[model samples]
Target chain A: MPKLKRTDPDERATDFVESLDRGLRLLQVFGTISGPATLSDLARAADLPRATARRILFTLAHGGFVATDGKLFALTPHVLTLSGSYLRSNQVVTVLQPVLDRIATAAQEISSLALLDGDDVVFVARSSPTRMFSAGLDIGYRLPSFCTSVGRAMLGRLDDAELAARLKAMRREAVTPQTVTDPKKLLAAIIADRAKGYSLVDREAEPHFRSISVPVRRYDGTIVAAINMGAHVDRVPKQELIERFLPLLRDGADDVKNRLL
Target chain B: MPKLKRTDPDERATDFVESLDRGLRLLQVFGTISGPATLSDLARAADLPRATARRILFTLAHGGFVATDGKLFALTPHVLTLSGSYLRSNQVVTVLQPVLDRIATAAQEISSLALLDGDDVVFVARSSPTRMFSAGLDIGYRLPSFCTSVGRAMLGRLDDAELAARLKAMRREAVTPQTVTDPKKLLAAIIADRAKGYSLVDREAEPHFRSISVPVRRYDGTIVAAINMGAHVDRVPKQELIERFLPLLRDGADDVKNRLL
Candidate 1:
């Protein structure tokens, strides 16, 4: 679980602040752990020296971003403000959240919008009719793109050469038994989705979960993101998903495109 | 507006990482400014030297946390991951979101949960029936505690002496024409809400927006947060809010208590 993308800046860069990078990395490390972590645990998880980790943690604590109880440290709610700035200022999230909410209510399923970040798709806005299937799918949740409906839907918008490069660069893994790990097959699937105007992934990203997605295009018809509706396989058959939700998702995407700049 | 509270740690602390603190402050400054910002604008907003701001921006940019055009910088979606770790690990948000969604759907208004962070209440979870009135009340939105129903409800659970001290320390201002700024009146209102088991704020924090909230207690009877439903004053009168929404909020709060640790 190396969360930092390979695109991370070179440490040798003169202006790169290693301490700030390490501190941010440490914050993400806390997310990987279940609960409060000790100094040793945080240091090991962050792959930093214990003394360095302690200094970073102390700084975080002083800023009210981290909470401590004797030997254990945990993040405080103040950390939410870090993302609040991006989310509030993001036009994609601000404009499309209502569309997703409407789609979720009308379709009685979880609705989400994801943007391609690095080789992964990050959920930027989401709405749910119920709490079901919220795990790992909330706003800010990230997933490998090649194996997810939203990922493929967004990838389908890329030029063939760029898509091929991305697919080759992706570290394809069998997230579930149904996941497509072959590059050629995945590319074909994405191409077909591009032609069909949507992408559907069945039990590929998660067990028993299937999703259908369509790319949301900006005014110039450039794809900006992907919007999707996901459900448990037990509740939604493949045919029902295609026949019922695709039109709704497309309409929602259209609405978003009209509203978004 | 000084977003950092007065409780900010003494910068003279031995382990204080000034660069890290300045980087985090810069991130918040971007949020305050709309869209992309010039380096000078960001430096001015963050009150940092141009050279220092440039270095931090380069580090953030290298980390993919900040995006820069030829002349301007904006936060990238990667910033969301900073909060993602906290939100995903947070029990309060994980446990209360579904409950809030249920309340919102049932009540046909927006429902939210807020926790006291310093003298402000930070919205930790929220659900909306429609996207109406969501401008400044989304999850992670922070508001002064004295004038908000959710804030008052959470403060009501504080011991009288602590509450008095908090009110005395508060930088109360007339946020709206109807906002009660006097410490004594705010304290009395909080006390009355505690006695009645709910807090109602009418056009105090925002014009034409009224909300009713109930304190959520932990298994040990310690107040953990507050849950509320808010609607436009035009849509729901003060009498109807108390008569219809108070019990629903209380029940939601009770459900949260039963489920939370």
Candidate 2:
């Protein structure tokens, strides 16, 4: 994964609290590994010295966010409070959850809400029907902004200069045979989505998966996020998505805008 | 809320990262407040010096875990990665989510799985049917063990001495009119649940909520978590819960135990 971009030069200055940043980075490293990690494993993955990693681990364990069985360290359920704090305090999820749940039930597919964080679209809220795709696209799942339906929908709201800049900064790749990798073509697709009020992608994010997304606007008429519903290509034909799910998604986005403060 | 217990004397020694602990505690304080907070608000709530809190907030902002509009600071969607990391790494939620979803759909109610964390049970996975109660019982919701059905189900698995100690340590309060506050009665109820292999609570956690829970065990027969289904009291009678939900919850628990490694 790419590192978080440091926009400010004073990140290394005295006011930054370097150990706090290292400790949080270590927490993110746990997600990249499969199971419990030893001190050496964490130090190697986080690119920190063993002594610094050990101190951070000690602090995390003392905070009840990480647990240890003497030899290996793993995150505890207490870590959920950090996410819970964000979900509960943020108004976007609170406003969009029920709206997306209604859309998911009506569409009989997985519905999700995502926001553009840096260059990736990070899913923040989701509502799933009984039947779902095997992609495991739960909350916090992230995908690059140049290819996903939700990403295109959200990027459509950006100004021309910013859109071109993000598109240039992205490590554009053909993740699937159908993914559009050319910068000019990607820009044209996003521009078309801006005119159409929605975006549709076919087999770009995952094979046999098709999704349509609509941008969610706030009370001030500014786009805050994007909402999408998706299904398998065999299950949902491309034409049917534009006919059935597009209106439903647009309605859901409108409801969210009206409800959001 | 009470602070995390520090059992190791070495917490005050050189190896501990005090700023990291303070920064995490500040994150928790955000959950206790309403929306965006000023530096003074966070410093007061976290009980840290203004300068200390300011530096930590800067570090968190640099890490993309927080956002600021110059005057007020709020958590960004990036914070969800912390909880997402825990969920993705923890095997228990991976095994229980599908089982709980099936149970919830079949029962037409809300089903959840929670693990024992200190004196509280933190909800880690949940599935809700089309209709749900007004309470926001999403993942990461926390309730005291002495009153909630899932809490009692898991607490019943603890050794006698430890269970008694936790019960005594709790700040025992009557959250609702129907809550059981007496320590002896709470212990008796939990012990009965142990014998019966399930726990049922009527209007204890909330005024009109009732739930039935079954403990989820691992391959070694040690309880790791608990699963439950709940409904409004008027919608589900006590006898109906035992006859209908109890069997379903037990089957779900058995399925989780079998699947978990």
Candidate 3:
């Protein structure tokens, strides 16, 4: 019998299957939608032909990642295992959870860790203080990096070319009156924040909310993510925030970096 | 172009791509491990031959779900989108988050929502009171159904045969001295909990931790999940948990069921 040719490095393209890419994209289509989706809805959303979508859905159902009522398809809890694996391997969120807990209570505000993903920042872990309103964010919630404190802090760590490319790529549309949408202004602000070792965005993501963030860095000086404490503007002024909570944010970042080891 | 065969109900076998199946299995292997793993480690853990594992890993890495440092591979935060879509579509956890938050703050304890997955209960959402220790669980942590209050509350809502099969499949060994390991005794306790509209687990998971839980049911009386409040034994005794917190749990459950509509 002939060998599968996987032993040769150049034959990797033959070994790497393309259908798996399509299958994962199918799952992503299901995620972007709001509720249970029909087969045609998924096919259209994923930009795949209906027949291919159906077969992939069948395979997914057989795999336990999905379940359907013979019409509407939704993912099962088993899918969480995929995210669970990521969280477990990353270890930063798990190890720094205690530190985040402390920062929230000590600062009496909501705190979170967010990693830069493309032009968005994804909240990886969060701790909330008891309050009248929520931050309206869950673990996987995303927000444009140019308009958020956590996003800016993470962005401040990138090299000049990367930062310029990402800023050029962003929509740069203002979310609020205070949002910095101009690419040049955003870059100058990021450079300033980097010099100050943190980013403090006031009434940017929301009118009432302000976030103060510090980039979590490895011992080698590479930024891994950002940690922040968010409070209502009326509850805490920007100056008081820097004085009272900045230390906790810095400590949280240090604790997170230590966990990356 | 030749017509794709998905139009025929009998042709699913042709559509189930084997490579996609193996690719998912590889991700599961990463979930099982605690940290970054080598290619051989993943192959052995996933029970796949090294070539298949390498090819699948290549596919996953290209998909941006898996990242490596030339030696060890790990899942990236982007994988959360798979579960994120599930959570977003399910709507139960998102709607009930406020209720869980209110319950946590009102009762001065931690509250979580869990759904039954096979023989285990998986926490889908959680909120914690400002405290020193964590709830020690994240989104997808699983535990045996018979020992924990959330598990037993959901089990209480199940019909006899379903509950019996789940109980029979459980390990049933004591996690703590307080855990009820015998099936008949566990079933009787579940029946008792069902009769009372909630389940109270006293130090079942740990000697110092106690929890009270209630089943979340649809308007049609079909149970969907369980919501629970967990506190330390020294802070809240079992009787006060029943008297003070049981009503809150039921209210939260009712609120959750309304969101199912």
Candidate 4:
């Protein structure tokens, strides 16, 4: 099993330089669980003592990045400026969104853009109709890279040595019955994805859901991210996913690369 | 004139504490000005010396928030995770996006959620159809509070003293012929917005565009933000804006409030 590393609050708090890391950890705590948290809840969530959590919350509130209503502390709209800055600076989102919108409208399925982050894929942009799914996957959801189409597409871009290292460190526990747990089979699947120029994941991360993904390349021809079109297995047959969705996904990726380049 | 602060790069460079601010400024420089920038381009945009810009850019590149190709630097999708944290932490965005989407779909116009920042309004979220006129508004875009329907709606939420203080510090300038440049008239508009529960502006920020806006309240009854629907003047007449768009904007605000609460 891969060793699980807990965010060490004590180690983070020991040095003044690490306080930034501590502050980021406090921010990260908000995403690890669902719902808003009170000061006490934040302290427990961040694994910091109550007094330390109070100071960090106070400072964040003073900076207008977080809001407190005399009880619970939640993020403020100003916090979006941090991420909005990222989206704005990176023109790929602006370039990709219209393409994703077109794909979503044409295919009538959920379309998403994701990037590799340590053994996980973080969703950066998505376009979907309201009735398709009640649990709306917004801009921040992170999922394990081993089980999702976007993950496989991104991993397929990496060289064998790096890919092997990543596979060696992956946690192989099944998220669903169809999840690829065997290392050798997963490696083969990744190799197949590279040859095919796209990846198709079926009921791996969640049962009854199918996703097809293609890599988004930069002007230099390096794979920086991947795009995916996802839907229920009943709504989209595997053959239909490849035939109908794959072309649109590839076209969208090409458009993004063209506009960005 | 309101004091224009120069972002002090020298003070920022020596202090490790200011690294966050420096890093954030580097990200801000990338917003819409250019796709990829050389070190000198970043220095000019960030108003820093080449050396300072190089250091910050190098650190960001090392952190995977940016990618450099020897000559030019560009932001990567990994930066989205920072804003993603903020979006997930604030439950309001989840509640608000659907309402904004509905308004955009209904009106076939640009709809946005904005929050007050000092004497300005900063857009946090926006939804728009392909034919919609954006008026150059994007998330994190800031504009004066006196000249926009969304700005007036948010300003209406402030008490008299707070409102006066904000107005007193602002430098009123003509954006377009219809812009409200008079302080007294702007104050009256704000008061009227409070009484009517909405604000409307015609050709104020730009020619041939009109907008209607309403405040989004939290469960505690505080106006946390405002939402706006914008259309070309030819599509939405003054009366039509108040009659048709107002209810949609208000309904969207109410829906957002219900979900958030």
Which candidate gets the maximum lDDT versus the true structure? 2
Candidate 4 chain A worst ten-residue window by lDDT: A1-10
> Which docking band does candidate 3 fall into?
acceptable
Worst 10 residues of 4 chain B by lDDT: B1-10
Residue-wise C-alpha lDDT for candidate 4, range A1-261, written one tens digit per residue:
111121222222222333344455676687665555777888898888786666566555555666666566666556656666666655556677777778877886668888776688987777764332212225656789989999999998778878877887898778888898887788889999988999999999998998999999877677778999987888778999899999999998887675545
Pairs of colliding residues, candidate 3:
none
Across B127-195, the per-residue lDDT of candidate 3 in tens digits comes to 766653333237788888789998888887668887777787778879898888988889888988888
Ranking by TM-score: 2, 3, 1, 4
Question: Model 2 chain B: which ten-residue window has the lowest total lDDT?
Answer: B1-10
True contacts kept of 3: 0.43
Model 1: residues with Cα > 4 Å off, grouped in runs: A1-12, A101-109, A128-137, A219-221, A234-244, A251-261, B1-12, B101-109, B128-137, B234-244, B251-261
lDDT of 3 by residue, A31-114 (tens): 788767788999999999998888888888778777776677777777787777777766667777777778888877778888
Worst 10 residues of 1 chain A by lDDT: A1-10
- State in Å the error of residue A220, model 4: 4.7
Model 1, position A160: C-alpha lDDT score: 85
Query: What is the C-alpha DockQ of each candidate?
Result: 0.32, 0.41, 0.37, 0.20
Between the candidate structures 1 and 3, which one is better when assessed by TM-score?
A: 3
Model 1 over residues B1-261: C-alpha lDDT tens digits? Answer: 011232224334777788888988898888788767778999999999998898888888888888765366777878878877887767777888787777777787778888888789998777766543332226688899999999999998778888888898989989999999988888888988899999999999999999999998877677778999877988999998888888788887788676665
What's the C-alpha lDDT at position A235 in model 1? 93
Query: Which ranges of candidate 2 are over 4 A from the true structure?
Result: A1-12, A129-137, A258-261, B1-12, B129-137, B258-261
Ranking by DockQ: 2, 3, 1, 4
Better of 1 and 3 by lDDT: 1
